[model samples]
Target chain A: MDNKTLEQLKEKANIIRKDIINMLAEAKSGHPGGSLSAVEILTYLYFKEMNVDPTNPQWPDRDRFVLSKGHGAPVLYAVLAEKGYFSKEELMKLRKTGAMLQGHPDMKGTPGVEMSTGSLGQGLSASNGMALAGKLDNKNYRVYVLVGDGEMQEGQIWEAAMTAAHYKLDNLTAFVDNNGLQIDGTNEDVKNVEPIEDKWKAFGWHVITIDGHDFQQIENAVKEAKETKGKPTAIIAKTVKGKGVSFMENQVDWHGVAPNEEQKEKALKELEVRI
Target chain B: MANIATREAYGAALAELGEKYQDVVVLDADLSKSTKTSEFKKKFPNRFFNIGISEQDLMGTAAGLATCGKIPFASTFAMFATGRAFEQIRNSIAYPNLNVKIAASHAGITLGEDGASHQAIEDIALMRAVPNMTIVNPADALSTKKAVEAAILHKGPMYIRLGRLGVPEVYKEDMDFRIGKGILLEEGKDVTIIACGFMVHIALEASSMLKEEGISAEVIDMHTIKPLDEEIIINSARKTHAVVTAEEHNIIGGLGGAVAEVLCENYPVPMVRVGIKDVFGQSGKPLELVELYGISAKDVAAAAKKAIAKK
Candidate 1:
């Protein structure tokens, strides 16, 4: 939580952002909007918050993370590589056939991913399962899941929310990347997932809101989640559609489109100066 | 040992499995009493999870539990387990090839009075279409018990369908039940009647009727639908030169379709299917529905006779 540590995490976040752009530009297709939006959150967790051992991804006592909003695999793939779960060469093979990094988070193919999630709105339920299992085995490992704001349109998320709170799975924490924009348009135009915080609160989750781009608030929210008991926590992270790059920021067109050569060069240049 | 419903056998087996396997966990979507998962819930209260009327959450949560090394038995009425939560079961549990056992109760038309809405007539077909899914529809209570035990020992996703009606005991308690291996109940030469679930019991009765008519009929308990017992089916089809498939499901995609796919490719035979002729069930007594839906013993006998006549 020190300034020095925070600065290091910020530099890591910029690297992750650059990786996201580079992978998408090479793959010729991937979700860039949500991936960029979640850079800081993934960077913070992999670097500081989560008790994950990249060297031993299957360590039983280690905390588990499910990328529920799995379209953002580039971010997770980049962070896992940066954290040494796999080599940096695997990042270049993103979405390629016979690659460890799939189009979505595949737990079997990838080392660090805890659950195979691509279809949205199902990750939180799986996270609940991990937390519930941890409690049953009397283990102290916590569970974390990252969901998208548009993913909330699916009813299963609410059902899982009720389940997590009902079981008093205080060991679980979920982050909704409230990037405000989805594939079709703004969340308000697509399905209107506003009053998002109140929705989680009504579902009995200990709700927390934070600027997702800020690493300090991300770490503090995770700490607060661990301190709370007898209930799950939902940290509604407010984020821009594309956080770092100039042309892609707050743009719905970048939700799934890959960048061209010129655009990728420009984005990498901007991130380089930030690093 | 006793005549009981398949659902009842599943509940008792679950409670017994709880004592043997500490990592075994049970989950239901608010129909514990009806599905009989309540028995396991009673014995292992701490390990039981009732997600309360949400089948999607029930399946996804079960997948999570499986990931953590907990062998989760997610149970519900077949209609919801395979019908309502189809995609969740496919994407969350089956796609990952997770070690989750889905023991769905009240399968087929014998669920009675609740009619077609509750009856999971096509549950097997739905489950069979998914990759990495093993489908087991037990003949009677005893087989249901053995199937549940085998499902737990197997290290992947399995769909064990149980019926609501109490059926006559077919296999003895000491009978060895192996997955993907058909149980030949009776042997004959005229025609073979391959059946599953409640229809297996009727196939036995139909074989008796065929015996009286001087037409020898072979009876097969085709329990495992997916990873089907092709050896037994082809062997029987080749021997009898005629076949009849019976089930408490639509004739289109259930056991009949599976048998036809196997026979048409391997050993072609004149086959007649006795089932719910691609129509929905109406509110009636379980027996009345069986007779009305054309899946009763007499119907199987008729289908067998028709198939033999063709030969």
Candidate 2:
């Protein structure tokens, strides 16, 4: 976590953000708000945290990541592409017919997608399954999953929450992208998901709250999660709905609507200046 | 022949299979005792996961285990497995074509006094609609055991429907069992009785009754409902010229609907269906419920006669 390394990581995040904008713009439809909000988390995992080999995507002992909030697939696709899991050119063909990158994260079609998740609130359970297998097989590989703040409304999430803790899945870490806004409106306007940290704690998890955009906090939380034992960890990441793009930031309307060419230009220019 | 519940056979088969396949894992949604997954649990407690009463998590966890090369058999009542968590089975398991076996017990009205809420009379239709899902409704204990073994060997999602009632054995231990092929139990020329699950036994009884009436009846045990034994059904229809379908499920979509579809497309024949007449069941004994639901041997015989008269 040196200053130089932090700066490099920030630059990579910006590049990923730009890629998200371009991908969504090209596809003409996708959830850009949540994808942009999760850029730094995805960047840290793929670049600095996860022990995944691009060439051997299906390596038995490799760390696995499930995008539970699958609407934010652009962020994962960008990060995977940057990690050389696939060519950067494939990012542009996302959500298009005959493209390897589907509208949702399809594990069969896309490389580095550990599980196919689109319907919300199922990823943590799937991650727990992998972690349980890892423990059974005596493998040291960890499991990570990213869930949306709005996606917490699903009852299955709580069902899986109890399961992860009940199994004492210490190897599993879940990130709740608390960007506030959902498709219809803000979380407060929709169904409120406040007391998220206490909820995870009550469900028998080690809870860590952090400013999601901060790389130092992100790194520290991951390190602490690895150090903890006997239970899973939930990293409640407080992030903006759209982080890099000023126009889309905290905007509920941008939750699923793709950015037009003019909006895309503005978003990319803002991201470039950050780098 | 011994009378054993299909769920009991599933449990015994899972215990036996656990010794052979080290990668096998069993998951249950707190119905281990009822669903008979407790058999696997007792044999391999470390490999068995009781996922509480949450069927959604049960299915999702099984999907996750499948991705890691573990053969996960997720068990619950057919009502909950196919109804409560249908989306989980569809998106997480079947959409990816994972190697997960949804061995649901207590299918149809035969689940008895738990009544209509617990009975999954339409599970076959629900499972059959999902792509890449192999539906196997075994007729007896031996076939249930074979179906569990076949599911382990098969490399995709499978729904093995098991019953709660103790059914008479329809096959011996050495009976040849295949995934998508039908087992022709009897042959005749008047009418063909295609049945699945507990209804196969009733169909056999109906065939005997038909013989007493001087009508030759053919019976086929269609264990695998999806990727259905179309060849057997078409050939049997051509020979018999009339067909009767028997199932404990609704006549709308179960073995009857599947057979009717195949016959209509391939070889059109006069068909009559013997099942629940598009209605729910009430609390009663298993045999009493079967009789009241109009899925007994007498009903199959009457339906067979109606089909023959139409021909």
Candidate 3:
């Protein structure tokens, strides 16, 4: 990523956080906590990295992205709309009936979405396929997959992890949105995924721990992933749930329930000043 | 007229796909010989993966490879692919709508000596249950080739069902194949015979037999079961007044069930389903198993006769 482009992306990522919260607030039915946690990761991928042409969404050689933690779709929609994959106007239509932006990312409707992922553990495996395909086709494009910390508890994720590491998909990068909160509550309260990075490393991934909200850290980790050879990279991003908002930070209620009108105004105001 | 096995067509098709698309990879769970993906492995050793006899692992691994940008085609018996790796196919492939092709061979009673354990009588229903899975049961060797090619080009999780024994080549190499579409063979006004996979032959033969018996029968190869060719099936039902659906599968939750579900919802036509009667098969000859399960041409003709009488 160019320094100017990186700086621009850093600024855009801050705006995305505000957009995510506001969109959730508008929908009055979204997962702001998770969405806020994954903003920087999506911004770095769409704005700085990934070989994607917004015009040619199905470019076979383009790098692929799968938002495995589907509830956090605001971050992805924000990034895709901003990157010109779709009209930014469609961002407000999220979760509304007849909207291209469904509650979950539907590949048939959404441009630049490699696969339809809403279920917890399936996204990593799909990304693993894309990475393996890149190797088979001798393509330089990488596969990026984002997973929720709570979602890692699903057994299918581990199965995919084992397969990715076993196959030596060096072109694959998986980022865990480790915000410590799930719909039920905290990750420890729901399902303890302690030693998360160690677990990924044991599964043969090149593991990296980073602050998810930090643009520089996220960018550096992705850069390291591109450098890693013969092993899939896993970024265990330690993040605060609803990091940008003061009222919703580390709060479980905001996981799925979108902010009402009053809450939306406060969130947007707080996010605008902080970033 | 019949010569080589349909599984051999799969082998040839895989080799062709590997040649055309470098990204086409094959994953075999120690069933390369049975599933006949050995040809694909020979051409693309770098793209071939032998993941032991773990069906669950095969599905997940295939999903992973697809995620990485490879169009992974995992080969195994239909029973193992659908039965054993069901959850993986559902969660990893179908749920996410990944482009993983499952080349499931030895489906239905044609699997023969392997008995009920290996026969995949419920694969169609099992796969069709998934929201976005494309359930394809190609009729003949040529149709298998076309179906395989079509499944690859189409973007999504697809299950391509193939037979074990040698079947007739019903279509020419130039025949165009489309996913979610049915191929209409013999059109008649007496009774429509909607079939898939091995039963497509039976339906064709039944059409001929029904013609001889002064009962005109419409025959359709409903290859894509999940996307039930409603346009053709409904039209056939409306014109013929009744329908006979055939397949070498269980009476419940198979092609018969799929067709019945379609008819019940839309047309409500009188139908006779000719397939396995919700029972398992015993060790026997391929033909013997097909006949014993009542999925042969004669049974289909009898079903056509019955469906016509219902009118």
Top lDDT: which candidate number? 2
Q: lDDT of all predictions, in order shown?
A: 0.92, 0.93, 0.84
The sequence of per-residue lDDT tens digits that candidate 1 reaches over residues B62-154 is 999999999999999999999999998999999889999999988878788987789888888899899999999998878888898899899
- Largest TM-score belongs to which candidate? 2
Off by over 4 Å in 3: A1-10, A51-62, B1-4, B20-24, B49-74, B80-101, B112-118, B126-135, B149-158, B166-194, B200-243, B257-270, B279-292, B296-298, B301-305, B308-311
Which runs in model 1 stand beyond 4 Å of their true positions? none
Residue-level lDDT tens digits of model 3 in A1-275: 56777678768977888778767777778778889888888888888788899999988878888888877788899888888888878888889989899888777678877766686776776676667667766888888899999999887688778878888999889999999988898889888998898899999999999998877888889999989998999999999888888898899988888888888888788866645
Interface RMSD of 2: 0.6
Listed models, DockQ each: 0.88, 0.87, 0.29
Q: Kindly report which residue pairs in candidate 1 clash with one another.
A: none
Candidate 2 docks at the CAPRI level of high
TM-score of candidate 1 chain B vs. the reference: 0.98
Q: Candidate 2 vs candidate 3: which has greater lDDT? A: 2
State residue A117's C-alpha deviation in candidate 3, in Å. 1.2
Candidate 1, residues A228-263, lDDT tens digits: the string is: 999999999999988899899999999999999999
How many residue pairs collide in each prediction? 0, 0, 20
TM-score of chain A of each: 0.98, 0.99, 0.96
